[model samples]
Target: MTSRVRLGSLIAMLAVAASGCSTELPGSAIAAEPSATPAISDARSGEVFGDLKACDLLEPTTTPKGFAAPEIERYESDNGCAAQKRGYASVSIYLVPEAGIDQLSPGQGTKIPTKVGGREAVEIPGDSGTEACTVAIAVTPNARMTASTSLNEGTNEEACALARELAVAAEPKLPRVG
Candidate 1:
């Protein structure tokens, strides 16, 4: 199981590095160095991309720090349209367990897009026993994603909403030469 987790982490890291951009990891902004972590060899499960390029997902063991702040486990996939000059698809799913975090969507008078970066954003309410929250942001574009989180961890709807915001944040990371 530990090996599986490490392998998942490595794939997730590669996907992010390939994009040439830095993203936050679940629980903290600090990253685990590749040279320090051992590699895992195993047959992977779950299907993400069909025709498009799909990378591994990052699973976090801790909670995040701020609003609409990017969770660390998301991965970006390039569409392979070398000449299109478009950016890679960014995806991240994080749990926001704060009481009001789940309700952190744009203000009542605010406007939000259902889909950003070609990936639709969704929020599912949840509870971690200690708090009432939501399972926010199961993002995927150029791929499919399914997230089933535990109820004991609480939810952060605000953070989930932020995941979408973070995914779109990749817009500036695209290559200027592309």
Candidate 2:
């Protein structure tokens, strides 16, 4: 075989093997698959909240005075939960892994960089400013604690401020796991 042809064949073989194209490699013992079950795509969510519900993130002790107690609801469709303070604001949390921290843009409302529980975050103003807000906290490199709120009881600024407070309360609650 020509040296060029031999080199081409080797390269192709390597590429196929790298991509798991062949189940077994000649003269080489294939490593055994991991005995442990593979992690779920959204496993980070469970890991961060472990045994804790979304409503648990609402800490009345940590909640400010202006905002009333939250009315929490859980949805089965997407394993999501939300808590709302009637007429004042409503905050909801979900697990967005590796979600970007910077959300400043036109027509996305006013986005301000801030901190929650001393962690980096961005406050995205909600529609009807008086009734909604969403705070995205960078809890971990792979997990983003998104706290969105709706304000019905106060001005846009009030709701955004409330959202920040709620995010602060929930930040510490999340597991600091990577």
Candidate 3:
């Protein structure tokens, strides 16, 4: 009798386990849709590296009455970042071309190469003219990710990172023209 009870219990347990493994669950019928678009695709962001190939240097807007606008330069990238000399500073913008984002960096502003060239070059503070800044939007590969960065003294490194995030979060992507 004891042996029979044990065997009965074992069989019941096996039956329950088997039932759980059966394909009766609705989840089993559902298939993954490859066509589903990702929320972070290149079209959603102002990325210049991927689907968005270029960005025009728009005029910098005015800052508040008391505060001044940092010098900014509108830059666009094709395959990679391009370098330019402005006074004592250098601005660069990098593009992934596939992802659609642009990465920006502004170096110390220096003087232009000239004939006499005896005048000393000056470094513009990060807070100078609006044209003194360089912005970049960077896009990663299949991720279609976009990001941006600005170089201003008031903008901390963390702030710059956030700016990049904001760039990635911008809008539909296009191509670089100018």
State the C-alpha lDDT per candidate.
0.32, 0.61, 0.33
RMSD of each candidate relative to the true structure: 20.1, 12.3, 19.4
Q: Which candidate leads in TM-score? A: 2
Sort all candidates by TM-score, best to worst: 2, 3, 1
List TM-scores for all candidates, in order: 0.23, 0.56, 0.24
Tens digits of lDDT, candidate 3, 81-136: 22222322222323434432112223443222211122111122232334332223
Segments of candidate 1 deviating more than 4 angstroms: 1-113, 127-143, 146-155, 170-178
Error of 1 at 65 (Å): 7.4
**Better candidate by lDDT, 1 or 2:** 2
TM-score of candidate 2 versus the correct structure, residues matched by position: 0.56
Q: Candidate 1 has what TM-score?
A: 0.23
Give me the overall lDDT of model 2. 0.61
Clashing pairs in 2: 87-152, 87-153, 129-156, 130-151, 131-150, 131-151, 131-152, 132-150, 132-151, 133-149
